[model samples]
Every structure is written in structure tokens, then in C-alpha cells.
Target: MNVGLGLPVDDPAALLTWAKRADAGPFSTLGLLDRLVYDNPEPLVTLAALAGATSRIRLQTEVLIAPVHRTALLAKQTATLDRLSGGRFTLGIGVGGRADDFLATGLDVHTRGRRLDEQMSQLRRVWAGDAYGEGAGPIGPAPSRPGGPEVLFGGFAPAAIRRVARWGDGFLGAALPPRFMDRLFRDVEASWKEAGRPGRPRLVAQTNVVLGPDAVVEDARRNLARYYAFTGNAAHFVDGLLTTPGRIREAVTGFTEIGADEVMLYCWAGDPGQIDRLAAALHG
Candidate 1:
């Protein structure tokens, strides 16, 4: 399976430096996460900057919350990024779990799932150059790839899986345990088949890592705690951080064994050197 790196969105200097290093490294993809009312940089805008900075690495949003944005605008931005990146962008989208994010966007949190469903359909139509109304012409700078970037849907719910089968090209699994992934992989396969989709859905798994000395590990733990504090159990994520090469390798192997086509290692701390350390560990 191919390995990818998740860009740290909290620090601007570190994020840009890491993006450059990742583009030059052996990593197959560089990914970002999305959140409103957070310190992290906006995913799409960050990606556009990285697109200008790098040439080879595939760019992705680990999972962009689709329900909060206007469908046409999202489609336009995604298509623009895909074209700007020379067709190296893959869009992973979901109905985000944070109620505050929805509230901040002034969107109804309860209608997220339905909103994402409708948005995905509209996204396809927008990317296809279909006129929105009688007079409007197609959106410009069409996606470099046919039908826009590959859309990967992320969520563990039955409705989410159904949406994946219907509209998504892949499944994006984030920070899920192996047992859960086993079940999820099976469900994705079953759903795809039941939907009469022609081929198996691409499966991608993501998790955070913190590999270095004790100081680095502790820093990562603290950062993770702050990042996931909204979840009410930051320690749960902190405890799961990969602090050793052995642990990172084990996680990668385990995910690959369960049929993940790509595994993205997200760095918890904003240390730019973490990229080289991770690259060495993966290669070593």
C-alpha cells in the first residue's frame, strides 16, 4: 500500500515547510483536515498554496465537511484546485461531527447528512459543466480529471456508507481502530456490490503519529489533547498517538492487511523535522 502524509494546519511556517519537504520526499500524498472555529488553516486555501509550492505529491482534504458550504462554490474550488495541481487532488468529504462547526456556519446541524447528499449530487452536476439555470453557462477552468477529482466519502454510519456507494469513488477511514476498520471494509465492499457499482471502492485510512524523543512525544500528546478537547476525551487520542517507529509500522501493516489502499500518517506536533523522521522510519 502507498503511504501519505497529513499536513499540519495549525502553524503557517511549519505547514508550508512540511508541504515542500513532503513534495520532495517519498510520500505519495499530502493531506489536510478541515474545521471552522479552529486555529487550523482553511483546507482549500492551504491546498492552493501547497499546489503552488509542490509539483508531485497528491493533494487531499482528509475529509472536508460538505454540508456547511454552498455546493456550487465547493465544486468550483475543488475543480480549480484539481486543475491547478495538475489533477493531483482527491476530495474526501463528509458530514462533520462537530455541532459548533455547523453553528458557526449558520447551517442546521441536524440536516448535515441530507445536505451532504444533495451537495454531492450538485457537485457532480457543477463539475460536468451543466448550466445551473436557463441562461448561465458552464463553470470555467474545468477539472483536469474527468468528472472532477475522485470523491471519497468518510463516515461510519449506514447512511454514510450508502452515500459512498451511490456517489463516492472511495471510503476515507480516520483514526478508527482495527476491529472497526475490519467491519467498515466489509461493509464498504458489500454496499458497493449491492449498489451494482462496477468495481471495489478505494479504501484509505488515516491516523496521527508523533515520533521522536520524549520531549517531542509529550509535545505531541499535549497538542493532540488540545486539538481533540472538543470531543470531551482528548486523552483517548493522546493515548493512541504513535510514538515509536515500531508502533507506526505496526499500524501501517495492520491497515494494509485490512485492505487500505493508502495510509496517511498525520503528525500531531507542528515540527517540520517530523516529516524526515517519518520518511526515514517508513523507508527504514
Candidate 2:
């Protein structure tokens, strides 16, 4: 399995440094998190900057909230980013669970799932050169990849699995436990087969990691608490933080055993040096 690093979206300067190092490091991809109501930078815009900064590392929005954005605009932005990155972008999308984000975006929280379904289909159609209305032709410039970037759906629900089978190219597994991930992976494969997709869907798993001294562990826990505070269980997330090399290794091995194509480690602290620590832990 390949390893990737998630960008620290809260600090713009630190994120840029991390992006550059990730490009030069042993990591396979650079991942981003999205939240409109948060301090984090917008994933697509950040990715465009990273595309200009780095050449080799693949970029992914660990899961962009699809229900909040206009379908065609999102499609155009993604296609443009994919082209700019030379086809090194993957669209990991989901109907986000944050009600505050929905309210802020003037979107109905209850209709998110249905809206996501419609949006995913529309994104594909727009990417496939389908004409809009009367005057607008297909959205351009065309995606670097034929049908746009590889679409990966996040969330582990029956509906999410069905959506992946129908419109996505892969599954993006977020910070779930190992046993849960095992079942989720099985369900994804079953759903893909049931949907008559030709091959197994790609699976990517995400987890949080903090390395270096004890201060770094505290920083990670504090940052995680702030990021997940909206969930009302920030302590739950902080409690699961991986602070040691052994824990990180164990997490990586477990994900790989459960058929993850890639394991993305999201750094909780806003420090660029975290990438080097992670690389040393995994590769050295």
C-alpha cells in the first residue's frame, strides 16, 4: 500500500511548506480537508496553488462536501485543477454531516443526500462534454483524464456505497476503526459487484498522526480538538491520536491488511517538519 500526507489547512504558510516537502518527500499523495465554516483554506484553491508549487505528488480533497457547492461550478473547478495538476487530482466527495455548514451555505441539511446524488451525476455529465442549456457548450478545458479526475466517495453508509458503485471510482474511508473498516471494505466490494462495475473500487483510508516530542503530541491533540469540536466529541478524536512510531506503523499495517490502496495520515499540528517525521517513521 502507498502512503500519503494530509495538508494542515488552518495555517496557509505552514500548509504551503508542507505541500512543497510532500512533493519532495517519499509520500505518494497530498490530501486536503474541506469545511466552509472553518478556518481551513478552500481545498480547490489550495490545490491550485499546490499544483503550481509541486509537480509529482497527487492532490486529493480527502472529501469535499458536494451538497454545498453548485454542481457545474464544482465540476469546472475540478476539471481545471486536474488539468493544471497534469491529471494528478482525485475528487473525494461526500454530503458532509455538518448542519452548520449546510445552514451557512443556504442548503437544506435534510436534502443533502438526494442533492449529492443529483450533483454527482451532473458533475460527470458536465465533464463528459455534455452541453448545458442552449448557449453554453461543454465545460472546458477538458480534464487531464478522460472522464475527469478519479472520483472517490467518502462515508460508510449503504447509500454512500451505492453512490460509489453508481458514480464514483473509489471509496475514501475516514478515521474509522479497523474492524469497522474491514466490514466497510467488504460492503464496498459487494456494492460494486451488485452495481455491475467491472473491477474492484479503489479504497483509501485516512487517520491522524503526530510525531516528535511530547509537545508535538499535545499540539496534535489540541488541534484535533479544535477541528472536531463541531462533532461534540473532540475528546473522542483526541483520545485516538497516534503519538508514537509504533502506533503509526500499526495503523498503517492494519489499513493495508484491510485492503486500503492508500493510507493518508492527516497531521494534526500545523508544522511542516511533521512530514519529515512521518516519512522517517514510515520509510526509514
CA lDDT of every candidate: 0.87, 0.88
Superposed model 2: Cα runs more than 4 Å off: none
Clashing pairs in 2: none
In model 1, state the lDDT of residue 173: 88
TM-score for all models, in order of appearance? 0.97, 0.97
Prediction 1 global C-alpha lDDT: 0.87
For candidate 2, write residues 1-284 as lDDT tens digits.
69999877667767778888889988999999888888888999999999899999999998899899988799899999999999999999998988989999899999999999988777888888887547877878789999889999999679998988999999999888676798989999999999899979999999888997878778888889998898899898898888888889999999999999999998888767788889888964
Error of 1 at 7 (Å): 1.5
Score candidate 2 by lDDT: 0.88
